[model samples]
Structure formats: structure tokens, C-alpha cells
Target chain A: MARVVVDVMPKPEILDPQGQAVARALPRLGFSGVGEVRQGRHFELDVDDTVDDETLAKIAEGFLANPVIEQWTIRRVDA
Target chain B: MARVVVDVMPKPEILDPQGQAVARALPRLGFSGVGEVRQGRHFELDVDDTVDDETLAKIAEGFLANPVIEQWTIRRVDA
Candidate 1:
């Protein structure tokens, strides 16, 4: 088995309200010198060892994510 | 500076509709043997060198994430 890690984030031009809110609230959380906060999601997916690159790309685009608002990268790691 | 990695995932019992959807769609995307898709998010935050573990824990809880539906962990890495 192979492990795939997917990190998904909002497109740069798109406004991220959650990230903005986090940035604004961090200081109040007691870190007086903190700067920006960019929020995103990380997924650990277990892919079959035999999967190919092209098929993985299609999985990423089709249902693995929402391409309009998010970008994802997959890295294969030891199972 | 130090780097912090945060991985946010829906609590195990909480329904991850998006992840479930992805799991179902993978087979159609030509990954015939794909099993599950538990999607989450990852973020890398640069922390100042002076930060202590206690303050970092506050940052992880208060503003760095949503405690109700999400859980996050931070790791210090070289900047």
C-alpha cells in the first residue's frame, strides 16, 4: 500500500474569510507578535500500490477536490 | 524563525461528507481498487523563534483552528 498526502488550499486571488478571521484573532489568543494565518486542509489518502499518475490526476480533479476554489497536491509516502 | 505544520481534520464521529463523496467517486475515476478518502487540511505557519510551547498551544487552540469540529497539531521546522 502507498500513502498519499493531499494539501488543499484556496486559490491565491480568492478571499479566505476563515484564514482572515484566524489572522485577526491570533494576537488576542495571546501571541502578541504573530503575523498572518492561512488556513487549509490536509488529507492522508491510502492509494493502491498499482495506481498510475494519470489516473491519480483525474481523481484529484474529479472528486478529490473542488478545482474552482481549491488546489491539491499529492505526495506518495511509505504505507 | 520556525515553521509550524497544522493538520485539521473533522472529528472521527463527525460526518465528512466531502470525504465520503470523494471515496465513492474514486472508483469511477479509474482507481478500481481505491478504498477510502478522508480529506483534511494542512497549513504551514512561520513562528518567531521566541515562542514557547505554552503560547504555541494557545495559538493552536484559540485562533489557529476551530476546536469544535476540527483538531490541529503543530510542529516546529527549520525556516
Candidate 2:
């Protein structure tokens, strides 16, 4: 079995309320030096060796992420 | 400004319904080679040079992630 890691993030132009919430909370928590905080999704998959990069990309875009607002990248993780 | 990326993942013993949903959907989507799927949260923060590793970890645990079930790691991203 092979392991793959996928990272899904919002487009730079998109507004991320969750991130903003965290950013705002940071100052209250005494970490006033922190700036923008963007939140995203990370996925780890265990797959058969037959799964190729293209297939992984397809899965990431078609199933794991919203292609319209989010972009994802897949990388093979050493087992 | 320095960039830092934080990855928050569910503990290995915890149940991940979101990941399971994705795994189940994969077969229906014709990507049957996939196995276990685990979902996590990723955060990217822009911080001043004054922010140290310990502070980053604190932010990640206290605000960005739930330290109980989710474990997070922080890394500096190249500009």
C-alpha cells in the first residue's frame, strides 16, 4: 500500500471567515504579531500501487475538494 | 513577514467520518484502488519575525487546532 498526502486550500482571492476568526483571536490571546491566517484541508490516503498521479489528482479535485473555490495538490508519502 | 504552515490531523485512534465518506465515495466514483482516507486541517499564517516556534505551537494548539484530538505541526514556508 502506498500513502499520499493532499493539501486543499482556498484561492487567494477568496475570503476565509475561519481564518479571520483565528487571526482575530490571536491578538486576544496575546499573540498580536500574527497576521493573516488562512485555513485549509489536508487529506491522507492509503492506496494501491496502481493508483497514479493523474488518478490521485482526479480524486482530489473530483471528490476531496471543490474545484471551483479550492485548489489541491497531491504528493506521495513514503511508507 | 514570515510564512508558517500548520497541519492539524486527527489522532490515529480517533474516528474520521469525513475521511470515511471520501473513501466510500471513491469507489463509487470509479477510483476503487484507494483505501483509508483521513481528513485534517491546514493553516497558513503570516507572522512577524518576533513570533517564535513555541508561540506558533501555542497558536496552533490554543486557537488553530484542538489539542485533545488533533495534533498539529508548524513549519516555516519559504518566501
The best candidate by lDDT is 2
Candidate 2 interface CA RMSD, Å? 0.7
RMSD of each: 2.6, 1.0
> Which window of ten consecutive residues has the lowest lDDT sum in model 2 chain A?
A25-34
- After superposing candidate 2 on the true structure, give the runs of residues whose Cα lies further than 4 Å from its correct spot: none
Q: What is the Cα-based TM-score of model 1?
A: 0.79
Error of 2 at A7 (Å): 0.7
Span of ten consecutive residues with least summed lDDT in model 2 chain B: B58-67
**lDDT for each residue of candidate 1 in A20-60, tens digit (9 for 90 to 100):** 77767777665665555667777767778787777777777
Q: Assess the local accuracy of residue B76 in candidate 2 as a C-alpha lDDT between 0 and 100.
A: 99
Taken over the whole model, the C-alpha lDDT of each candidate is 0.73, 0.90
**Among all candidates shown, the one with the greatest TM-score:** 2
Residue A8 of model 1 has an lDDT of 77
What is candidate 2's lDDT per residue for A1-79, written digit by digit as tens? Answer: 9999999999989999999998998888788798999999999999999998889888888888898999888899896
Off by over 4 Å in 1: A66-69, B65-70
